[model samples]
Target: MLIDEAYKSRILRGEKTTTIRFGEYEAKPGSEVYLVITPSDTAVAKVRITNVERKKVKELTNQDAKKDGFKDVKELVKALNKIYGELHGEDEVTVIEFEVVEKFESGIPLKWLKGLNYRNPEEIAKLYIENNLKDSPDVDLIIRKVYSEGLKEAVRRYGPKRVRDALLKAYHKLYADGKI
Candidate 1:
């Protein structure tokens, strides 16, 4: 879920407990959410949904408005109208009430990744193959892990195609070098 910087800070400070969005929310109650701060694109906290309510805009009460960081129903409606543009009081909105479960550092810290010991995809593939050679060898799992986790930052920096190509090249190189 995304929020502006001001609201993100409030959520982190345990001031905001509810978020109102202009549509039906897909997340079920009890599901965890990573609140991404917009403009910065940094995930700062994790929250668990305690309740989710779908109701018309006009149905919001003062309590609901307070949970959403508004002083009262009028202010909440005004803010909603400004963001949504001409909201008919009848427009549906999803009120997601959550509790912050944990706070996270700004971004993926390079320091922690460095501790993993593998610098690139080739090293990752090499380690995976070596570790699983005596057991069940699942190259697909290594590929998936690399694509999803190891190369996440790279994918964000250089784009998916480039990162994928590089990973494939490294995997093939293992066979070429007769290391697997």
Candidate 2:
């Protein structure tokens, strides 16, 4: 779901649970969806759709507007007009209600991690090794240890704080980039 950046704070704060769209959007109840902010296309949070309703513009009430984080029906109508042009009372619209499932501390563009092999501590260690430590003499041995023993075991065996710090940094980078 692509939401306007202006409503990011509201969504994060749990104040905006409903969104009114200009058409009959194909969203199913109980489906989980990522809420990506527009322009930047950053995935900020995950949400579960609770309901989907179709109604005419005239049917929108103050309660609906409130759920959408609007002051009143009039305010919602004006905003809708700005987004969808001149809408008549009988025009149809889709109302989507969702609940926040998880919020990302730092948002990441979804595209960056699409090609990643895995999302875990091991993957972070691998990325750190391959990208930053590839030229070191012990690189081959470290790679072998990482694959054979896994991240936790390798960290315990080596006790390399640099490697640990790198792994932590890589994990946060991937997480912020929406990989993990």
Candidate 3:
């Protein structure tokens, strides 16, 4: 499960307990989910799903938004539309409730890269694969990294949602090349 910085912090701090996804989520109630902080594939914690509820976007209550670290339902809806495009109040959504079980120091530590200790992009790509993408069937580590790393400037210029779209596009390309 990927989350943005704010929600990630809230989850770590034990403030946020519920997450609202815009559509269907296949995980069972008792399944474990590795929470990865987004714009980067950094696994920060592990959580166990306690419940899953499906409802229309309009059905989200202020209480639900509060559990998600938002001030109210309106705030949650606005943020959702910004990230996932315009959504009507009646749009279907999945509400997931989870509890953190464990945390990690550095899921994908970039300190070595910052210190110029890595061999090459390919090696780093492989390292990423070993750490996070091993079980993912159609995601190319290298291509994903290319977009993620390459979009730093764009992320700074445009922001996370757009950059995330670019990264997803890159990953989709990998599927076509049979490298996923």
TM-score of each: 0.60, 0.66, 0.59
lDDT of 2 by residue, 1-180 (tens): 989999999999988999999988899999988888998987788899999999999999999999999999999999999989999999999999999987765564454323233233455556655554343445445554655677446666776554444444555655565555
Residue-wise lDDT of candidate 3 within 1-180, one digit each (tens)?
A: 878866777898988998888888776799887787877766677789999999899899999899888899999999889988999987898989999987754343233223223222233344444444432433353335543554344445555554344344443443455554
Query: Model 3 segments beyond 4 Å from truth?
Result: 108-180
lDDT of 1 by residue, 56-141 (tens): 98899999999998899899889888887877778899999999987764342223223332234535555545544322233354
Candidate number that wins on TM-score, 1 or 2: 2
Q: How should the candidates be ordered by lDDT, best one leading? A: 2, 1, 3
- How many residue-pair clashes does candidate 1 contain? 0
What is the model-wide C-alpha lDDT for candidate 3?
0.65
Residue 30 lDDT in model 3? Answer: 93
In terms of lDDT, the best-performing candidate is 2
Each prediction's Cα lDDT score? Answer: 0.67, 0.74, 0.65
- Global Cα lDDT for candidate 1: 0.67
Candidate order by decreasing TM-score: 2, 1, 3
